[model samples]
Target: MAAHEKMPDFDVIIIGAGISGINFAYRMQERNPELTYCILDGRHEIGGTWSLFQYPGIRSDSDLYTFSFAWRPWTGKDCIVHGSIIRQYLEDSAAQEGIDKKIRFRHKVNKLSWSSSPSMWDCDITVNDTEKMSLRSRFIFLGTGYYDYEEPLPADIPGIHKFQGKVVHPQFWPDDLDYADKRVVVIGSGATAITLLPSLATSAAHVTMLQRSPTYIASLPTRGVFEAIVLKILPSSMANRVIRLKWMLFSLFMVSMCHRFPRLAKSFFLRETAKILPPGMSLEPDFVPSYNPWDQRLCLCPNGDFYAAIRSGKASIHTGIIETITASSITLASGKELHPDIIMTATGLKLRLAGGIAITVDGEPYNLSDNFTWRTAMVEGLPNLVLSIGYTNASWTLGTDSTAHLACRLLNRMRKRGLSVIMPRMTAEERKELEERPFLALSATYVKEGGNVFPKTASTAPWQPRSYYWRDLAIARWGRYQERHGVVEIGLVTDLSR
Candidate 1:
């Protein structure tokens, strides 16, 4: 260490105490026990998405077996469960591993700057939204998922403010809000609306899902007889791995079928969905989406609860474009009107990477979009930084685990080489010749709308966004990442005074 340079407070600073952050912490402890680290979160609690969202009937769209960490088996009875259960699971995992002790809640990182002189990252943070502090670390792990927690995508209704009754956005659902024996209209066809309708219908007088268009709604079995038999036969540890692998393979197969044979997959989905709806109800505008299957994520309706609610005369679906909102009702462009006591906007979320923290390299502002990714985890020209974005097509944690393993491997390689800094670099000429692609794999609306904020991808290896699990697993475990056409460069820093 140079005499003029100050020692970093910790070797690594992980931002966010969510699933990815916890998983990374565990991997670091297991793979590199000598490295010191701490987790910083803006919120007072853990579980980034699970903690923030408190809407009724909030649950994981993906099965728990696949969504959870592979190291820690999910022994829950139901494959799909409520949000509170997930929160408790995360809390338990963190507490058990003693990772919770290293977390500093309410430490919101505002900006990060890479100091070349010290070969470290200087993080500017706001503690408890009042006191400001700065901390330095040799590396930074961004476990903050992509999405704006503070504000949702603006409600696009023309005259929503004119409505006299209560309006709610699921992102910030009020604990005190009541809709018992009252008519409610949820305005969106996405997952939140699908999940909320059944729960709201149980108590509300009438719950109507009003949407401009339809989204693919599919019924999923929470637990089947096959799973029960398997659990009964295999050991607890083996059963967990078996179920997790089964779901992983099944999910991949379903996605591949949808992508390769859209017409056949759409027909199969439509046919299966029609079987669950009430006899008199038609599948025309209510369940038939304009786009093909898997264009957007399929809204999983567990045990056909959403359809069951519709059959019980408590919930209904209305498809049309909203013209305006009146004091007591909403008027549609097709001359239809809906009178509800409460309105809930399940529109969508805005994408914000790394919790919207400003980044600078040697005092110059850093724009993530300008750089390409290395192994879909590290960014080009960014040293000792790792991003924990998950797969859009499958369970998020699977991709997260892959990134964690690859990051640990990179750190071990750095230690072996006696390197202080490592970055994925592309020659100016090579960068100019490379074609740019969208960072996210999904073609969802929000992804396309807010695409520019994320990093770019290319047609070639390493630069491409992480997609295939088996391929990425192999690469993360044993691929020569740095030998990919001179993309990655490592350096050993010398004394600052020299």
Candidate 2:
């Protein structure tokens, strides 16, 4: 802390200038502009997750409607957009909404300490990763998406250090690294690996995706006829609305179908792949997943790009355990050896809370998992902290519509009640009544392995995320904030104003 430096003050502090933070800013601008706020992004850039990764083929697995902000109309080509496009959309939306002005780039929160007596958060801001500054706010909204951007999960493999090939992790892709005409082997069966396969295969000598097991892959049209008709016949705004509605309904229907008829859904996925896959290609060895649909996120092959690459002999999928990594080659447990010039570990991201920012209540750093979540937006008993996390099954932004609205409600409530602090505290009796459950049902290895550290949910109402969009819309978005939401108590304050 600078001894003579004067701390800046704001009513609310939003951490992360990413899409989620931008959406929060838009919502606040729409209904609560009078509330003072600042958008702080840890990175030098504004695009959060998109800006961080500079991989070969980075694109949104989910469609644009659900991935993008609700209030903003996604006039872009339907869904499955490239990362650069998404990044541009974020910047354009922020600039158009005048939210970009509020963003302070390279401002990372080093330490967050809550002052119980003052009912405020004292944050240590590291400017440009160097100079120290202080910021005080009544509330903090964590828009920092769930993953550790600085350090990805360790790809600790046996004989990894002995490998002479250049190893790469998708999280931190060096823009200047030349992989053109290089034989590349990507390890993993998750979204990152699936996305990287076709992309690297385009120019690489050969790209081999090595996975321990098969992952469910589904191929959909690059552009739908109905989507084209809707956009062509209707106004852009109307088209966006109609398309958004259609996608939402269709997403829900698909989810229901997967749960109700897993066998049929699984068969349909394979049947579709059968059409696109190369003749005599065995879907059983590498494409078919043992888990039911939605048990894990289905690998989306928009327009069958991945399969097309396989058919063209540009890429291949290999499934087996790794025996060892030899210089210029990888030996599999199945006695197959793949010689590659480069090995890219598309393993997975490490799930983290608030981007690994240290948060303390009363000067004591509290483990996030120690307390259960509230409405999936905040931690129980944590005062004036709102973490905006999106849905894993659908577009990440879908959950934000409700979360931002709920934050507005809480802030408004605080003003109406003339209070500085609002903490949702529950008794032991209440905690016991709440049913315990895992936060995510995702079958992806990264997600499943993150179980111990990931946030927990209660079976009790308002404590667990219903995982249904409509439920969130009714309770958090449009509905009034009530006591059943939690037992929120206020601290003494002479004046409370947004």
Candidate 3:
């Protein structure tokens, strides 16, 4: 290759040096070491989500066995790994694999445009908050996971700006704020809220959880004997098989727990919760969720921090409509007021697809919403764009690994055929059929209007892989890899009509 003044053009440009990005880059290089690639990350370091969430007691909801990459098994003692450890693992993995040198930290991609003349992409990126640079590549891989951008906290309440203690969003937590000896109010019942309350309660005078509606909560052993057995008796390959089996069985048990005996499931939670509450405190129906189990994500407490806080009388759960916020207090719908020195909004994240990257084909913008039949993260009509959206119900990494493996296969196939672009090409009938059939619709909030878009595959619980892992694995491993659904062929520029 000839040297140029600017950075050499690469065969691929990967956004976000997080786990998915790093892993995908490694796979691409493994397949073809000669293919040049570069990774751009907004943060000064790797680890993506793990690096961003620095709150106390932050841990993985999924077990480490399934949460980690298949290539690198987790040898850590704790099955339910903490955020810091996960961050360290990811960073270490990158360094040990010699993939860290390809990464450009603090380089944030702002815009990407595809050029048909050279069959390449012109990526405009910002680095270190100052420099503006452009890079060209034949392929673009978006490893920017969701959750980086947060939903706007609606401040329509009566007096949000008035006497405010420290108002914090979990996404943008203050580094210097002291929570000890302060009364804290945590708003929202999502995962972040569930994880934060117990940690805050230890130092805060009191922590109150506010929920607008009920959500199902489930608990499992943070560390299990099965993991130990795999490490002791089974070889790595055999251990993976046993781990997969355990995952399936546990998934089934969860399904049954939610369906066959919902009341039993509810009681189980209540009883466990009561054990950690101070005397006279009970798991009241007001605090218990009425929705089906796993309808929303089940809040996890690996070390029983939530119940511990309640048992110590440091935490309380409140369910009601919030009227407004005063300078020093929050008013509920029942005309009651609770004073707090700090307020944390643990609201869910705003979902942005392709990291809000605008993708175009032959200079025409591709609107993903218009083409929604997702097959292994590839839309029906888009070409040369393969996404890694895992099963909504299982571990994120599980599905991501499968997606990366499948992408490797697709890329290999392309290389064998000497093809430039491969686009999904479903017929009108297939499109209509897919449109009519109901889908779980992973991006509900992202939809312009919210309602169930498609019927879930399984009406009964546990049988379905609501998690991205299950769905992606099924599609990648068993679903059609052949160009049957719809595969469009692209020719070189000299042969193009334009």
How far residue 494's Cα lies from its native spot in candidate 2, in Å, is 4.5
Rank ordering of all candidates by lDDT, starting from the highest? 1, 2, 3
Q: Considering summed lDDT, which 10 consecutive residues are worst modelled in model 1?
A: 489-498
Q: TM-score for every candidate vs. truth?
A: 0.97, 0.96, 0.86
Alpha-carbon lDDT of model 3:
0.68
Global lDDT scores for all candidate models: 0.88, 0.82, 0.68
Model 3 residue 366 CA deviation (Å) reads 2.9
lDDT per residue (tens digit) for residues 169-281 in model 3: 78766789899999998888777778888888888899998877755555556667877888788787787767766875676577557667877777777777666556776
Q: What TM-score does candidate 1 reach?
A: 0.97
Ranking by TM-score: 1, 2, 3
> How many clashing pairs per prediction, in order?
0, 1, 18
By lDDT, the better pick of 1 and 2 is 1
The weakest ten consecutive residues by lDDT in model 3 span 454-463
User: Which candidate wins on lDDT?
Assistant: 1
Error of 2 at 97 (Å): 1.1
lDDT tens digits by residue: candidate 2, 159-221: 778888799999999878888999998988888888898888878999999988888778767
